[model samples]
Each structure stands twice: as structure tokens, then as C-alpha cells.
Target chain A: MPLDTSTYALAHLRLDGRRWNELRRLHAQISTQAAADGSSYLEQGNTKVLCTVSGPQEQKGGRGGARDQGNEAKVDVEMNIAAFSGMDRKRRARSDKRVQEMQVTIASAFQSTLFTHLFPHSTITVTLHILSQDGSLLAACLNAATLALIDAGIPMSDYISSVTVASAPSSDQSLDEMDPLLDLNGLEEQELPFMTVGTCGRGPGGGEEKVMVLVMETKVQMARLEAMLSVGIDGCKQVRGILDGVVRSHGKRVLESKVS
Target chain B: MAPYTGIPLSPAELSYLHTSLSQHPPIRPDARSPTAFRPLIAETDILPAANGSARICFADGTEAIVGVKAEVEKTPSASSHSINSHSINGEVADEGVRGLGSGGVRDVEDDGMDVDGGEDGKQSSKGRDEWLEVAIDIPGMRDDDALPVFLSAMLTEALLADGALKDKLYINTRFHWRLYIDILLLSLPLSYPLPLLSLTTHLALLATRLPALVSEKDEDPLFNDDWEASTHLYPPTKDETARQKPPITLLVMSVGENILFDPSREELAVADAVVAISVTQSHTNTTGPDADADADADSPNPLHLIALRTIDPPSRLTAAGLPNSLNTSAGAGAGAASQSLSSVEVAVTREKDQGVSVWRPPRGGVKRAVLARMIKMVVQAGGVGEEVLGGLRGVEI
Candidate 1:
């Protein structure tokens, strides 16, 4: 709640004291599930997500049909939202439309990045579980998936980092002076028009320069569209920096234990 | 969604399990006795997010996690009907719901799910028994599938039979509590699932807490802010019968000729006949001018048999030697048992008084001795119910 109505500015950009460009505080870990080939748990503020990657293994016969497609092993994505994830208990069926849509979004995004030609006639499964929700559900899922894929030692073109940027209130309080809020949370998300952008690590344009991997927006005002995109891409870059740090630290730790 | 068919066994393995269970002393692969229950490891209030929660694990690789969430809802009848609570409150002592029967043996007929067959306890209006909702989710099965549906129905029926939930959850004439109990069968053993499911529901309901209603004025209900002042689902006291017991379903497995309780999945596979019986104890009030009550009071038999149900078995059994499934006995209450409860029916009811109130017995003949022993074991399990109440009392959360 802002004190001065005249200013029309938010007292703070978010519930947490994050600058317009500041991403939520994130903590990521890899290789947590021994049963799955690769797994990662990511917590951004109060939002928690666990991603497990299994496969490049034998595909069950009859399901895929005739080893038809010569290359490009199919990737299956399953997303489970625990009934207790929300404030109110809501049980979603296994075949929920929303869950299936999310799965397709993730599968298609990774289909372009993962080196599927390496493992033909096989399948890889990515399962994402939402343990808790604060906001930016889609972006958090993508971030967790990237780490899990890396942990599984899957070959990808580069880190596929994503973030959500929403139209935020400006300090000026003028209707015209709107700011883009990075990493929208459950509260801000419900009110603001936001966009989720997934970007690759390297430069934006050229061969594989098509750095923009995914862009999902639900009815946005045309005027602020460009701002949300720029802010979202910048947020993704910052996220990539954090993911790079985790993977490097994980590698160093593994090497240290092996030497010891 | 991949079908989660749990632990499939081959024919050879099935035979191996059968041979082991049929042995003279019952040499279980896990070395358990005929009546030995798997050691239960449990904790309650772990899921503080829910109003109340409990998790129980067993050695047979079965795990049940239950969470009871209570929501405050306006009682539908409260607005339209000024239920004559005032009249009933004075004459009908809270504990005097001693059930409806005046002591007569009768075969419990399969009166369908809504059997009004309780003779002695206090009868709350039939509509009040509608609050509890039980759902079971085993990873591999669909929510609408047969296994989960049957398990949920059995759990809800057993819990509702005594109307204990409605008793404790009633807040005021205008308001009441609705409990949504979710039983997550995280893992199912190869055998009977009722015992684990029942125990989990029992412990979870015991750990349930409802807000304390403290009103400054008479008309509307207000709640106290202190969580410590909240009350347990079952009132804490010496007179346990003042409330209904959390009904538990026990798996009765017939191996060769021996009757076993809480058989593992392997034993369940090869057992000649399997029956999962839901049992709860009602009061056998001796204070009433009834000869049967006096006889029972004198004989040291005070526990009255409440609701009994039989679950379908996994395999077929030949029914030549089995006891009648619809053995109602006395506790089928007076309201609905008018047609079934008769003096001429006294002999059959007396026979049922040996305490098997299930709908149908297992296919193969269970000797008279074995059936009698089964009832005695069920009755004896009631004493342990007190220990469970005590255990629930110790749950910190």
C-alpha cells in the first residue's frame, strides 16, 4: 500500500524489497534424486520446485510405433502439482489440461536445445513437481528443468534460462510512467500483465543466434510489450549467471570428493 | 499416466507364498505368526499445514499418510429447522446414546450401504452423518479405479457408522464442521490394504483439532484465538464410550485351516479365503431392564458389535463351508432392524453374537472353532483400542 495517492507509486516494487530489475533470491542444488538419472531442486523465495530427469533409455515397444523417426529421440515431460501447493487444497487430475499444456511447453522448448540425435530410438523423461508456489510457476519450472538436464549430462546448445516480467507501478505515480517488474510473484502476477521469456546463453541473433527460445504472454497491453520483453530477457541472463555458478560448484565438489 | 500396478508376482512365486503360509506353524517368509501384525511406525501432526495429519509405515512396504482438514460450514438444517435440541438435551444424557437393541441375536442383512442397524447408541438424525469425505490415492491407480473407490467407501462407511465425527464436529445449531480426510496410500503392500488404511485414518482423526468456539454473545458463534484451547476430535476422558471408537478394518486370512490377522501381501495371494472386516465397539448397557444385557454383564462381555462389512476378495472361493455373510447380531440398532430383529430369529442372532457381523464369510468352510476364535480376537482388539487412544493422547502435534 502506498502512502501518497497523489504520487500513485507503489511504496515498494514488491512484497520483498527487490528493485525493478532484481530477480527473487534463488537457491539451487543438483543430483538430489538417486533413483532418477538427474535431479534438481530450486527454491526462489518461497516457491519450491523439484525436477527429475530420466532416460535416453529403451523406449517401451508399441507406444512410440515402428522406430519411424530416424533421429531425434522423443522427450516426455510430466508435471505434477501437489494438492497442498496452494492455499486451498485442490486436487488436479493426472490428465489435467493445464498440466498437459505445461508439459508440452517444456518438451518443445527442450526439444530444440537437447542433442536428441545422440540417442536414437530412445526416450528421455522429465518430471517436474511443484512443491510450493510463490509465483512465476512457469519460469521456475524451466529454470529447474535446465539444471536437471545439465545434471543428467544431456548435451544442450546452452543454458535455457527464463524469467517473468510484469508491468509494475512507477515511483512517479503517473499512469504513463510504468515500470517492468522482474520475477513476478503470486500476488503481483494476479494483477499485472506479464510475459515469460526463455533465452539461450550466447548472443541474441545469428546462427543459433535465435537466442529467444520461448515467449508466452496472456493478453498484454501493446504499449508495454517491448519493455516486458527486454526486462524478461535481461532477467533470464541474470538467471543464467546463477545457474552457471551452481553447475561449476557442483563439478568442483564432485572432483574434490573423487580426489579425496 | 502409466498404470501403477504394484509389485506383480509370478505363478511360481505365488505358489511359494501359498506353501509357506499353509505350513503347520505358518512359516511366513518374513517369519511372522498367524495373528502377528506388522510393527507399525507412526507419527502425527507432521503436516501442520493441514488441520491435522498422521503418517504410518509398515514392514511390508506399505505406507499410509492421512491428513484431516476441517472447514467451518453453516449447517444446512440449522436455518430451516429449530431442531428440538432443548428437549433432547435434558432427557437424553449425552452418554446415554446406548444404542437401540434390547438384546436379541439376528443375522445382519446386507441392508445396502445405509444400514440403519444399530440398536443401542444415541441416534443423531440420519442427515448429520453426511460430513466425512474419504479419498484414497495410490500412485498407479486412477482416483476412479476400483481399488481406490472400494477403499474409500469402506473407510467412509466405517467412520460414519458410529456418527462420532458428526458428534464431535457439531459446533452449534447453526454451524458444524466438515472434515475432508485424504488417505494417500503412498505404497501398497502385496496383500490386504484395509488394516493400514484404517490405522492411518484412526491415528489421523485422533490427532484432529477444531477451533474452540467462544462467544461473548448468545446468537452467533465466535472462536478463541488460542490454538492451545482447541479440542481433540475425541473428548479426553475416562468414559471412552461417551464418544464412538474410530472403526478399524482388520484383514482376516484363512491359510489352510488357521485364521490369521493382518496377513502380508504374499499371504493374501495364496490364502484360501480372505475377509476384511470393519469392527467398532458399542456399549452393552446393563443398566437397562434387559435379560441379555444382564447375562452379558455377568459373563464379563460388555463390548457390543457395531458395523460389520466384508470386502471382495482378489480370488474366487468355493462357498460350501462358509458362515452366512449377513450375520447382523444385536447392534444392527432398533430403527432399521424391526423386520430383521425377531424372537424367532433369536437363535441365529445368538449364533451371530459369537461376533462375526460381516456380510458374507470367505468361500471355504471356516470351522465353528475358527469363527468363534475370530470374534474373540476382534473383541480383544478393542482393549488395544484404548491403548491407541492413549497413544493418540501422546501425539504432540
Candidate 2:
């Protein structure tokens, strides 16, 4: 039988000290490349990603090919986990399921925000190289990809940020009352039935607005799904504000350099 | 002709060519319509670090990025004899006859076009035949001289055709206001059609945006005794010139019997001949007196007008003969079998008004229809339209 929901729910919560709803600090840097069309480096707590964007170049291949004439642009995303990135060893290969999932997820997240049709028949590839993984690897990857795209000066609808939340199972407790954690690390991730939500816009509590782009639920009870989603969604809003600040400051630096 | 060495033409290729022509009465693949154009997209200022930059992405997945950077250099004396020599700043010191001399309109006519007639006229005569050098640098790629030559010629043609660098704007042509454009390509499929693949080339140009020179007054004249000395005391202020937007080229590729808007890598692999056409818009600013009087009241306003046209001569398969009809349905499958048996003659007339023709090997019965249809597809795919097709029909292939 599957592990008891109650046993894993908030099983590892350190209630006496740190609050369950608290989030880990996030940091990001932009304009990391001299040659690429755009480049950025982002780190959320322990998860880290380096992204590089190139092209709006000629469509490769023979003439009259799709990239030859129209406004449709192509996007290629590659995500690789180094052997030393995680606590456990990672094999040197692209066939891993986790890496593939990250690639698709990151690509999908950017695709929704990017005005690809404006580029018609052309391709823009976003490469994400994961240097380290703690927890919320997907969230970090998404954040890094967004920043890199902005640095590349690729136009976008808005920025995307992601957060993870764990739900404490208690039949006696109201679903809304369940403690919502933010930015789960590997240790927290291993012990809780959490969900990851990537949102665009700001967060509540006077932060940034939020628009949900992706959601991944891991080992959460169906009954507590709504409660967990709200928690994750709220946490994502908070993260978005922090990421936006980073982007703004970075932009300021770039502008200053141009001025000076 | 036997397939070029190991490059064997597939049977499917021959059959597709024949079938499309016979069924649809397709237009000749080589005949392009005046208005029909391949699609194009351009992004400017793509490289912020570069002085000027642009990227042109075509539908066929062929893309090119061009970056332009400018540097200051002392004007070389030897270049005075060059075709564009008078354009050099120090070489033409006499500004009076040349409006560059600080004289008003009347002085301009008297000196600008006549004073240096002997030297300027010689330069003007040679200008028509002069060639500008184009250099291309691709990181880690083999040096392909043909690519640079083709790209440079196309760029020069576009600049002239669009009048982007009219004589007025490009005043300092002699001092080697070299524009360096670098192109980087990320995706180019091997089976890519020539026409479409050609579109991915990116072009970026850098030139000094010199402000209009104005005369300045000199206060301290104790050391300057002569009128020429006082006049030379004050020089025009040279403001920091901002980089202008780089010119963009939109490439359109036509393939197969049909014109696929933007074919992907997979689709390009199967296509026959491809044609890549670059289109740029020319903008001309009318400021001088000569321009004002000649401007017609009833004609469309020419101020900052965009004139759209092709940049370079469209390339085609050299060995193929011109097609006889725009309609391809004259014959059927038998045409492919008989293509090897027939011999044809071809005469190339290199004029814009003269149409290009591709002659297929003669076939009997249904084969004729197939051959005709195949040729039709090629012409239509080449962006040729009804009028061009009509013209092609009038000519012997």
C-alpha cells in the first residue's frame, strides 16, 4: 500500500523554530555573457541554473524552408544535470527522464510568455545548464531561463517565477487552515507531499502580481489538492516579486553602463 | 548530364516534378511574378553591445545576424586618387565652390559641381564601374569566398536600389567609410533549398552619422591677418555621432511545385531547386533646391518614401533549359523517361526585362504533359506570377 498520507504530511516540520510557510532567500544575476545574444545566471536558495540565448540568425538548411520567410520562430531548449550537481551522482547523458522533463517544462513556460509568432518561421533556442540542484530544480530552471531571455532582449509578455509548497494532512483541520510552506529545499521536499507552481506577475502581501504558468503536484492527497495549490500559488507570488527586483536592478546596471 | 559525381538525383524527384506539372498546368518554377514575394522577418538592434546590429530570420529556418563596429583612423593621403577621393574630408579643402566650403546656394552651384569638374568628373565617370569590397567573418567556419562576394554584391545592390546611401547621405565615400557586417548562423539544414537558405544571411552596416556642418565665428584675430586665415580659425563642432539602424534583408524562398510559406528542415530536404530573394526598402530624403523644383505637385510624395525592390539577380540552375509553357499538363509520367533522350539549346539574355527559361528534355505523348507541369511548379515556386508566365510562354525554351 502507498505510505500513509498523515504519516508523511508535515512529518518533518520543525514547528517550534522555523515557520512552515517561510521561504528560502532567492538571488539572481543578469548580463553574464559578452558574446551570446543574451545570458543570465539565477539561483533560488540552493538550486542554480545558467542560461544562454543565441540567434535570430538565418534559418538553417535549404531555402524555402520554414525559417526562410515567415514570422514563426523556433525554440530549442536543452537542460543538463552535471554529475556533481546533486547529492547523488548524475550520469553523463541526455536521456535521463528528469532532465527531459525539465527541458520540456522550461520550454513550455517560456513559450507561453514569449511572442513566438512575431518571429515567424525563425528559431530561438534557450539552453539551461544546471550547475547544482537542491530542491525545486524545475522552479530554478524556469527562473533562470526567463532572466536569460530578458538579457537577450527578447520581448516577452511578463516574467515567470515558481515556488513549492507542502500541505499538512489533518482531517480535523480545514483545508484552508493547512500550513503552506514556501521554496522547499531537498530535505523538505523528501519529507512532504508538496506541489510546485510557476506563476507570472506579483504576489500577495504587497509583492508582485501572479499568473500561474505550470503546476506539478508530487505525492499529495487528492482531498488536500486545492489547499496545497493555494499555498503554492501564494508562495510563487512572493518569489515573483523578488525575481522582479533582481531583474530591475540588473536592468539599471546595464542602462548605467550604456550611459557612462 | 550525368548526376554531378556522387550526387544522384532521386527517381521520386523526377516523378514529383513530372506529376505536378501534368496535373495542375502549373506555372514555370523559374518564372517569378512581379508582386509575388517570399515571406520575411527582421529584428534590429539585436546585439546591444555591437555598434549596430540586425538579424534577418527567414521562414526556411535560415537565419543570419550582422554586427557593425566603427573606429577612427587618420585619412590616408594616397587614397586621394581613389574613385571616391573627393569625399575625403581633408582632400577637398576648398569649401567655397563646394557648399562644404561655407558658401550659400549660389556658391554651391558654381563651385560644387564645376570647380573640381576635371577631377570630380573623372571620379564620377569611374563611379559607375567601381566596386566596393565586402568582407565576412564567420567564427570557426571554413572561409567561403563565394559567400562573402555574393552577400557583398547583394548588400551593395540593395543599398543602391533602396537609395539608402544616396550621394548626399554618403558624402565621405572616398575616405573608406568601411561598413563591416558579421553574420552568425545557428541552424542551416544540409538539404536546404538554395533560395531559402540564401535568405538567412544577416547584414549589419556601420557609418558615421555626421551632423550637418555649420559655420562658427572667430573672436581672437590678432594672430590672423588674412581673410583666409580668419576663416580657417574656427572649425565646425564635431558632435559624437550615434549609430544608425542597420539595414535589414528579408529572404523569401520558393520550393517544390507549391510555394510553402516557410518550410521546415524536413521539408527542405525533399525540395528541388530553391530561390532566395532579398528585399530591402529604400528611403530618400529630398532637401536641396534641385529636388524641390523637380518635385511634381500631383505625384505621390517622395519625402522619406519607401521604394521596395529586389537586391540581387535571382540565381537559377545553369544547365536547365527554359520551359515552353506555364501550364505543366501537356504530358504525364512518360516525360521523365524521355527527358534523358532529348537535347536542347539555351541562350541567356542578362537583362531584367528578359525572362529566364528552363528547357526540359523532349518526351512523347503523356510525358510532355508531365514535363510541362514540373517546370510550372518551379516557376511558381520561384515567386514568378502570371505576367512573367505570359512572358515566358512568348519566348522559345
Candidate 3:
């Protein structure tokens, strides 16, 4: 059945008012647990993520194959979306496509930056559990994952931050109606085609600039690729800045707690 | 190594293999020696909320955090008699004496004991003996099975052997104190050597500091003196003073025949065997036959000598003789080979009195020789000294 355009438009406007380019207010707390090797809880707008890291220990059997370089380590990434995390309830599946994709993306991002070869034949597993999802769930997960990694004291080339961009057909009929919006929420995502990008470090041009570590796009026109990419990259850079600030403040607080 | 025929190879893989095999002596592009360790960065007391905390980062991006919390509780009645009665008095003596008086006290005291000591009569019956529990959380790696429990057990053993906790101080006390050390590990790049990283966690505890406190109840029962003001307060005897600092543990991982100190996640990936060494300083009496002659002369600083030694090895695939088989064909023979290799032994040596050592594992053959040389080069590049090296040898893996 064809969807009602009018209702969708209203939802889109409401989401837009929430701000496409502006990130949701972020709150991060470090060292949330005593037993974990490292742990952090991150909330991005309505999206909440709790991340924990454990083990540079010997890699488990089956996971450590013969071809694995004796001196090369491996990373295992796991993402769990609670049954109540989404607006629509989700049933748990051990190997769902979406969950698997997230796992791969997270593993790739950490792999590129982490010095895995230092620990030979060992495995570092990062688990990200989403308690709630409003929109930009992946971006929020990445941010939480990085914080947890830092808390764990894992070495990294740099911190990775993510942002989502949506391209809506412009109302003006003359040109192809496609304008890039930043930091899309669930409502905005449902109305327009959008893409999410995760990037490292800060960017230039008053925001932050860095290459995209992972990119995922929903439906979108090929003609607007360049513009959408630009906006998405910019949004990522901005997100990185926010994440950087959060990490710095978190580290300071952790240190201060120890002294006090 | 033969390429698998079943799977199609990407251009990147083809080139990686070609270049890797073509290079003389077959060195990785990163130029790290076989046993070379990546950089290590450690921050102690990283978590302020924790009683004691530490975070260690390996160059390869593997990180682990450890927090120690101390809580007070009554010791088990069955074990109360085993506690050293000399250290505690008054209320403590009453509790210990009452618990030791009858087995009926076991029912009362058992409820107060922690869950871990429920089974052991010796451990559970004690009223004055304190217990330390170490919990390890590996974020995403925790399984419904035994992984979490295993990690906790490994850490607990390490902490006990760490020589940091003042077990003697808590003995015979009315309230038996238990120090809970919780470790949270995150990220852990896949390339890290699991055994080495676990060993690092063990070693990091060596630097953990415990407050120095001695009871003044013997000299000033009312606690009226400004503690330090009481001259009658007994100083920690030589033996007690020697136990003040925790023993330091150092971790060294070997790739093939080479040994590296404090291997990072990346460096651990290529290591063949990892060893942790823990060192402690003990005072030996100078009353031997030769001591009589030396006693007449001015003694040199009492010779508070430090000794280096090896701790228990951690459980790892490599340590278990199961070589990493990512590139190998799957079969029964491969499993057997892995089991055999798990027993491979690495060599270690103490280099100085500063509690460090230089380790040189036996080269299995010519192929391993290359790896050994590479590790040596990496250690040299890092400028690790005898103290650091020997310390690594003493850590409990």
C-alpha cells in the first residue's frame, strides 16, 4: 500500500524543528563499573549506549584460526539492541543482518585505529548494548564504543565520531529538490532519505574534518551524491568535536575522583 | 604457507602474501621484531570512585582497567581459629574465641561469609581470616559459560600473589576485611596477545599502593595519643616493615624465540609465548658464619636485596600449545599439532638486583631464529633496561 505523504511530511517537519544539523544534547559518564576492564555510558539525544571492553587475553578456540599471524591479535565486536530499544519492539536474533552489519562496522573502525598486533594471538572484544534508539543509533554506538575503549586504556590512533545526514527533495520545483540536513532523528529519518558516517579526529573549517570510517545510506538520488557527502562529512566532523570534548572532560573527572 | 584453493583471493591478499614471502628474511612491513613490544601507557588510580584503580594501554589498542574496593565483614566461624591471634585483641579476640569455641558458630558466621568460600570448611570456618575477591569484566567478551568466571579467577590468583594486600594486618580482627578488585577490559584490539594482556593486568597490580597503618592499641588502648606522639607505639619490626610495599610484577611476551617487555595488543598478536614475572624484596639475616666477620665492620645498608622470579603462566591458546591456525587447513592432525605446540617452553633470566630480567627463549629451529632476532632488535629500540626486563620476568602471567 502506498504511504500517506501528508502525515509523513508533518513528522518530518517536527523532526527538522528538533534540528537536522544540530546534535542532540550529549551526556557521558566514565568508569561506570568496578569489575569491567573499562566501561562508559553515553547518551546522544534519545539514543543511549552502554559499552564495556574486556580481554587482550589469549584468543578463544574457533575464533583463532591457523592463518592468524602468531603475533597478530583479533577483535570481536558485538551489538545488542534491547527488546524495548526501538519504537517498534525488536525480537532477539543471534545473527540478524542489521546486527551483523553493525558488528562488522564496529570491528572495522576499531581495527583500523587499534594496534592489535602488539598482543599476539589474543582477542579484544567490544560489546555495545543499545538501551534506547531515537535515531542515529550507529553514530551513538560508535561514540560510546570509543569512550569505553579509552576507559579500558586501549591505545588508538584517534577517537572516532559519527553523524547522520538526510537529503530531502527541495520544495522548489525548478532544481532537483535535495538539501542536506545534519543529525537526523527517527522522525526525520522516516521522512527523507539519509546517510550516516563515522569519522576520526577533528575537522577544519570551524568544525572538525576527518575521513569516514564507515558510511551507511538509505534511499537517495545519485545526482545529489557530492552535496550529501559534503554535508554528511561536515556533520561527522562536528560530532567528533563534541565527542572529543566529552572524552577530555570524562578523563579529567576520572583523575579528579582518584585524587579526592 | 600454501594458499587455500577453495576461496578466491582479493588483490590485497595476493599482494600481501607475495610481498611477505618475497622479502629477504620475511619481515613484516611494520619492521617490528618478532618479539618486539609496542609502546605501553599506564595510568594508576584512573577511576576515582574505585578504591584502587589502574588502566593500561598497549600500542596495539588493547586496554584494561582494574579497580580495587575494600569492604569489611565478619570472618567465618569455622576459620576463625586459623587466624593469627597476636595481631588482634579485645573485641576481635572475643569474636575469634567465640567462633572457635563451637561448630554451632559456623551456622551463624557462614551467613556472613562471601559466596566463594561456601564450600571449603577450612576457608569458611575461619572467623578472623579475611578474603579478597577479584572480579573481571570483559565487556563484550563475557559468555554465559565460564569466560567471565575464568577471568575473575585468573585475576584473583594474581592479586593474591601480588603481595600487595595486607592479609596479616586483617588477621584475627573482629571485622574481617575483604578487598574486592574489579577489572574492566575494553576494546582489546584483536591483534593483542591475550596471554600477554592478561599478564599485563597482573603486572599492573604490582604498582598498586596500599596505605601504611599500624595499630597503637597495644601501647595506647584509649587511642589518646596523637598516634605518632606515642613513643611506646611499636615500630613495624624489620619483617613487618619489609612487607609494606607490594611486590612488582612485570610481563614479557615472546614471539617465536624473542622476548619483549610489556607487549601491546599489536605486539602480542605475533608473540608465540608470553611470560609474566613478579619480584619481591626480602631481608635475610646476617647471622651466618661469614656474617660474624662482617658484623664487626660497618654493614652496608643492611643489604635489602630484591629477588626476581616467575609467576604462574596465564591460560592462552599459544600457552596451551595450540598454535594460531588462521592460515592452516582444518583437520584432526592440525588439532594434535596445536596441542603439542601448547607445551612449548620459553627461557628467562634475571639481569640485575632492581628486579628486572632479559629473557631468551630457546629457538626451536632456523625459522624461529628470525623471530627471536627481531624481538631482540625491538627491545633494544625501546631502550628497556635491566630493571624493567627483570621486572617483566617476575610478573605472574
Candidate 4:
């Protein structure tokens, strides 16, 4: 049951004490893994992810020599979901259909963002280790990967920030009480039909924003989808604010340390 | 992980461990007895998303998590295979599904349970037969790797081969409970590899709860609104006839003159032979006629060894049998990987027919006495299964 609070809009639901529109308390750090060129550790609620970026160096041994893109650097993403990261002790094969799909999705999402053409013939490898999973696995991975890339000083058009929003009516109440909950956690995610939205080119009324990735695994009504998309977009922009602040402050700290 | 052929050892290191293990009482790195189990810490019913979930951690830093999700899929229309293809593929009438036009993943992937093979071949010819799917994920290993394929097939067989699990899953012929049991491997065991996977999955299965079937409407299994009303897979064993005990796997290693119950990476390196035996509380389990005698005997444990897999000598999980050279990066990278995974899945399904197929055979044959002792130790370990069953009572799900 949703406890009646100052924000009554979240009343009908929210088992985790988060408001309908509120994001999970996010704790992010850059350069978390010392070995990687750029690395980041991000936590959104209970979902914890570590991302490391290596290369833009020479291409490794090639098995598929036929379709190598001479211009854009190949972006290889390997996502590891730790067995102890979840409530279950489940180990997945690396070539799991979902894992492969995630790899493809993340690689393509960052492909357009990175100036791949700048480092032709070289490969940029992004590896994400999911240490804990609460909910919003894809969104958290996307967000953490973005920060890691930025930390590596990889060129990109804009900072990609992502969030997942779900229509939580069936799980909490009837469909008539359709409420689009932002940044859903593990439990809510199972009950609701959710979509992950990634946005870039975000600023305070500076210019129109761009939608980089909008993935909806479950079906949602067309009319309600519009509403969910708007809410998800707003969630992404808000996340961008936190991420941008971290990036700017990180840049300042690095410069100051260099001068010192 | 590729059954880590013992740890990477120089000739000197290998000789050292080989000589040490050969001594009486096994004077090796760990001072524990040959049969002593490493520490195992476990938690169950942790994931709210899964009907049943559990994580098991070993002292050696290796860990695994398992989640069991019970979903109701419409029984594959046994009569309309060709007709269904016409609807999905329009006019592509290829039964092999390989040449099916614009092949989506479902058209290719077995979706886990396709019991059209195995000893119970053609079981899918009638009503819903295949109701179980097991997926094991090892971090960083490619899908088609020999280790993953072998592990997945072995785990799936551990659960489904006996039909005890599937009998419990059958709500009705129209709609059977399909358990998508996903096991994620966190780390590789340094030495011994046996029960790390089996125990985690056993607990996960024990902790699994199936949604209550409110009613069957038009071949669909409608579930109750309250998840608390769900039924546990291993519910307290109030009635002996309906009971289906979780299967436990034991990794048996034979080093020199010794039959080690649990081998470390170093011990495995020097191991002469390895056998993975899956045991479960016995019932009228007539599925595998080659079942151990204890299945029919009266003992403290009604357990029986259901499946025994032999790993031939020193098949290093790291690099020995990897087909890395075959993977060529190209425009259809995802498609290529998907194709390879499907092929590996087919190969995995075929493994059921070859009873005791060796993944990679360890060379030296063990003394008959050593082999006999290993069996005795495994039978004694059945108490651990009962203790685990006791632990399942605490699983809130």
C-alpha cells in the first residue's frame, strides 16, 4: 500500500518509499577501476554497476575479417552479471541471447555518440560488471557506461542519461488508476510494463533534446505510451543534470590537481 | 566454467601436488580430509522478481546465483506446426526452421524445453511434454563455449531428465508450468567443481514457488492475484507420494591413488579423473534404469545418483577447447552469435542420449577401491541435502 505523503500522486503505489516521479538516490564515482583507461561505479537505488573502458588502440585478432569498418573504431561491449549480484544464484553464458542483445544495444547506442572515425582501425572496449541488480538494469548500465566513456575522455556528441518508467496499475491497482512510475526498482519492474529511455542534448531550455534509446520490452497502450515516454524523457533529463554536475566537477578537480 | 582442467601448473608444481595427494591422508595445501567439504554459504528466496531464487557462495571465492521463473506458455500446437509457420512466416513451410524466411530468434532457438529428443524421444508428439528450461551463465565466457554448453545440458538434465520435476510442473495437459531456471556463475572455483552449481540450483529449486492456477481459460493458465498463495516446489514433504526432492551434484576427483571428494585448482591440475554425480531423494524414479542401487534400498537417505558425467583429463576451461578462431566479427555479429548459440543448444540437447558422455576424459584410471570410497562419500553427503531441505523451510517464498 502506498502511504499518503506530501506528494499524494505517489500514494496508490511506491513500495520502496520512492515517490512516483522521484528518482532513486544515486551515488556515482569516476575512475573507480584504476586499471582501465576510464572507469565508473554507479548506484541507482540497489542497482550497482561498474564500467571500465579500455582501448581505442590497435584492433585485436580478427575472426570476422570481411565486414571491418575502416573508418569507425569498433565498439565492443562485454556486460558481466555477477552471480551474487541478485537474489538468485544464476550464472549466464556469455552468449546468452539477452546478454548478446545488451552488448549489441549498448555498442550501437554509443557508436553514434563516439567519434569512432577519429580512431579508425582501433577498438574501444567497454566492459560493464553488474555487481548488484535491483531494477532498471539496462538504464543503469547505459548510465554507468556513459560516465565511464566520459571519464576516458572519449569524444561524444552529448552525455547520454537514461531512466526507466513503468505503468504500475495492474500491480498496485486497476488499469484506470494508471500511474507512470519513474526509475522503477526490481519489484515494480516485474509488476509493471516498463520502458527505458535515453536522452542527450539536455540543458535548461538551451535547445531541444534528442532521444537516443527508447526500449519497451513489454507492451503498453499507444496513448499511455505517449505519457510514459514524456515521463521517461523528463526522468532522463533530470538524471542528466546529476551526471553533468559530476562530469564538470570532475573536470575541475582534475585541472586543479594538474596545476598543483 | 570449462571444467577447469586442474590449475595451470608447471611440471614441477604438478609433480609436487601429485606426490603430495598420493600420500596417505592426503597431505596437500588444505589440511582438511579428502572427503571434507569446503565452506558453503547460501541464501534463498532473495529475488522478488523470480518465483524462486537463491545464491550460494563457496569458500574458494567462486559463487553462483539461480532464479526460477514459472510462466505459462500456450501448449505448442502439436497439430498445427506447419499451419503456425504459415501464420508467422507467411508461406515459408520449412520444418527445419533454418530456412524459415526472415527468421526471428524464436524460429531458431529451442526455447529450452524441446523434449523431442532424449530417451523419451517423441514425447512432444502428443500434448505438452517439455516444460523445463535451464540456462547457466558464466561471466566472460562466450555462449557456444564447450563449458557453458556442457554445463547447461548437464544442469537441465539434472532437473528434467528424471521427469519428477516435470510431473510436478504439469498443471494440466493444455498448459504446463514452464520453469525458466537461470543460473549465473559469478566466479570460477579454484579447485573442486562439483556441487557448487548443483547445490545452488538445488536450493533455488527448493526455494522456487509456482503461481497458483486460478483457472484454465482457453488453454491459458490464469494465476492468482496474491503471490503468497503460490505453491512451493518442495513443500514440506507432508505426503511421500507427491514429493520431488531437489537434485544435488557432487564433483568427484581421482588423484594418483586417492579419490578426492573436492579438489582444489591445484588438486584438479594433478587429478587423474573427475566425475560429476547428481543425486536426489529417491522415489519411484524409473526414469533412468541405470540408477544407483540405493534408490531401491532402505537407508537414512532415500537419495539416488540420477546422472553421472565424466570429464576427461585436463580439459582446461580457460583456453584449451575454445573455438575463438571461428568467430569472425562482421556486420551480422549479433546474428552470427545467435546462430552459434542455437547450434550449441542443439549439440547440448543431443548429449542426453549418450549416457555418461565425457566432456574431456581425465587419463589415469582410479583404483577400484578409490572409486568405491567416492561412492560411499557421496551417499554420506545425502545428509547435506536434508539439511538444505531444512533450510528451505525458512525461504519466505
The candidate that achieves the highest TM-score relative to the unseen native structure = 1
Give a tens-digit lDDT track for model 3, residues A1-260. 23233433455443435444566778887766545677788887778777877777676555536446567667788886654356443335657898898888888888877787787778787878665677888888888888888888878777887777777655453357656777777767676677777877664433344564656556567887778777777777666667778778887886899999
Query: Chain A only: TM-score of every candidate?
Result: 0.90, 0.82, 0.85, 0.90
- Candidate 4 lDDT (Cα, whole model)? 0.67
Tens digits of lDDT, candidate 4, B324-382? 22233543665466455666664554344221222222334556676556655565534
DockQ of each model vs. true complex: 0.13, 0.02, 0.03, 0.06
Off by over 4 Å in 4: A1-21, A24-75, A79-138, A144-260, B1-7, B73-129, B187-194, B216-222, B237-244, B283-301, B315-362, B381-397
RMSD to truth, every model: 13.0, 20.1, 18.5, 15.3
The first chain of model 1 has a TM-score of 0.90
CAPRI classification of candidate 3 = incorrect
Q: Please write out the lDDT profile of model 1 over residues A162-195, one tens digit for every residue.
A: 8888886577656667788899778777766787
Alpha-carbon lDDT, every model:
0.66, 0.46, 0.51, 0.67
Q: After best superposition, candidate 1 residue A80: deviation in angstroms? A: 4.4
Candidate 2 vs candidate 3: which has greater DockQ? 3
Interface C-alpha RMSD after superposing true interface residues, each candidate, one decimal: 4.6, 15.0, 12.4, 7.2
Best candidate per lDDT, number?
Answer: 4
Error of 2 at A14 (Å): 4.1
For model 1, residues B141-213, the per-residue Cα lDDT tens digits are 6789988898887777666655545666766667777788877765433566788888888878777877788
